[model samples]
Target: MTMSEPLDPNVARAAKLDTATLSDALDKLGIAGQCYRIKPRDVNFRMTGRAWTLLYGPAGKPCGTVGDYIDDVPPGSIVVLDNGGRDNATVWGDILTEIAHRRGIAGTLIDGVCRDTALCRQLGYPIFSKDHWMRTGKDRVQVEATGVPVNIGDARVAPGDIVRGDADGVLVIPKEHESAVLDTAEAIEVAEEAIRNAVRGGMRLDEARKQFKYHQLQTRQEG
Candidate 1:
């Protein structure tokens, strides 16, 4: 079977939680999932789904296409492009954005950069990346591989990994530990909510935090 599995219910469950909560859960589980430096192109953009990874490298004698593999991405899957953090060239742009939006792809996450910000913003297509640039990747980069493991920011993302992004940033959840991560995140969310409610009810902030053991919420737990 391919590394990418059928969409998991955990994807749905993850959508309900923000990246901060999920990041904390990953910390508690000792999983390095926070995709540092990867930010949403638009503050309002958000997405959660399985990763469909692509790896890119310096262009060869005969440069390959930048986005041909996008057509194969399944609906509801996020396109993860690893461009080695090159900010000089863009691997994604208007055409790819239009196609992905129309195809029902969840979103695009790039380790490097993208272009055509206006189109992406206009279509409400979610894209998280290091940044956006006008220079094209056409002759600067080539598709090195697809459906393989890739690195986004500093986090490793394998095909089928759960990716969640929002205004805060992106976080990758390893498929093998998705359940544990989600469970921990939900508990953290509940505890945080309770603390908030207690504070709203006139309880001292310190007392609420002490009551919920909030300081230890994201502490690594050893088995």
Candidate 2:
């Protein structure tokens, strides 16, 4: 699909697929989309949307503001922050969480930390990050760039990439491969479900898996 094409339909389809399935799909495609070391604040919280990336770096002679870009983020867009995986300082807080939730933003994913867990939990705003700390990133770090490629938990995220997060953590799907990944994930889900059904119908677990070729579901396919 072209860059100008609407991604909402693919994003919607991806929203139904869990991180596990997506991860498997990525593996089958030999893609590194899994964001390791990043996890949701609350296990029950889940979110999916196109990424709006922000990169953070050490502050220069002058410091920069934190979370001033929230207002610019469109509804249903996921705010992805690349904070260099710094757990000592936080780039997100109660104010940002409150605004994002009120604005109907999908969620926030950070490579570093976020503060104000209480507000995010109360608002049911999903945040996947390395961890949470009370220290502010105001003077420690500054916004280096926005809408540029950034690394989050070892995963490279680009503007408009499909981001999915859940209790299992977060995964980034490259926009160019979104369609293929979603199609593969859906097919895997269907096969697994069939295996489950077969087992429930008195088939042995091993037999059901063999019948469904479960072992080959996630095996990398040669182009």
Candidate 3:
């Protein structure tokens, strides 16, 4: 989706759904979106917003700054930093956290690492990343591009793509497929809820599963 396009309402609905259901939807649709090896700093942390992507690369001869882009991020947007999964240097820190929180930015998602996590926890700001470290990215890495497509784990994220994350990790829903993905995910959630209700009402677990066609929830939908 273009940056100027208003976010789809389905994006908000998908945000209410967990990564597992969204992953299932993507699987059913044959889309690759599950980001591997990335996790939330705190399991309780959760974030959902349109992606505002940034690509990072090894610094040049003189090196470059780490986070001058924070001031440009819009509220409710997720800052997606692709650092090629580097764990040694952090692209996020307390200063960025405070500003982002104050500005109402939804959260930060990094394919690399972050630092000064204590402030993040204190402010209840969500941060999903590969890991955390104290070494700053100042002299090691620099922003290669902004408002461009970037990789997070194995998933490709573009500007305005819907980014949803939680304890299970992050998944990017391609802007073009947001509607279909959210529809499938909501259906799956409904079917699973029904199964739980049946089991609670004394139905055999196997019986409930069969009634809900549980095994077919993630099966690829046929044309």
Q: Local distance difference test, per candidate?
A: 0.93, 0.91, 0.90
Considering every candidate listed, which one attains the maximal lDDT? 1
Candidate 3 residue-wise lDDT, 30-67, digit = tens: 99999998999999998888999999999998877665
**Model 2, 49-117: lDDT tens per residue?**
899999999988767766489999988889999999999999999999988988888899999999999
Residue 119 of model 1 has an lDDT of 96
| Candidate 3 ranges beyond 4 A from true positions | 1-8
User: Which stretches in model 2 have alpha-carbon errors above 4 Å?
Assistant: 1-7
Which residue pairs overlap in candidate 2's backbone? Answer: none
Q: Estimate each model's TM-score.
A: 0.96, 0.95, 0.94
Q: What would the per-residue lDDT of candidate 1 be over residues 1-223, giving only the tens digit for each residue?
A: 2223235679879999999999999999999999999999999999988999999999988777775877788988999999999999999999999999988898999999999999999998999999998999888999989999999999999999999999999999999999999999999999999999999999999999999999999999999
Model 1 pairs whose backbones collide:
none
Clashes of each: 0, 0, 0
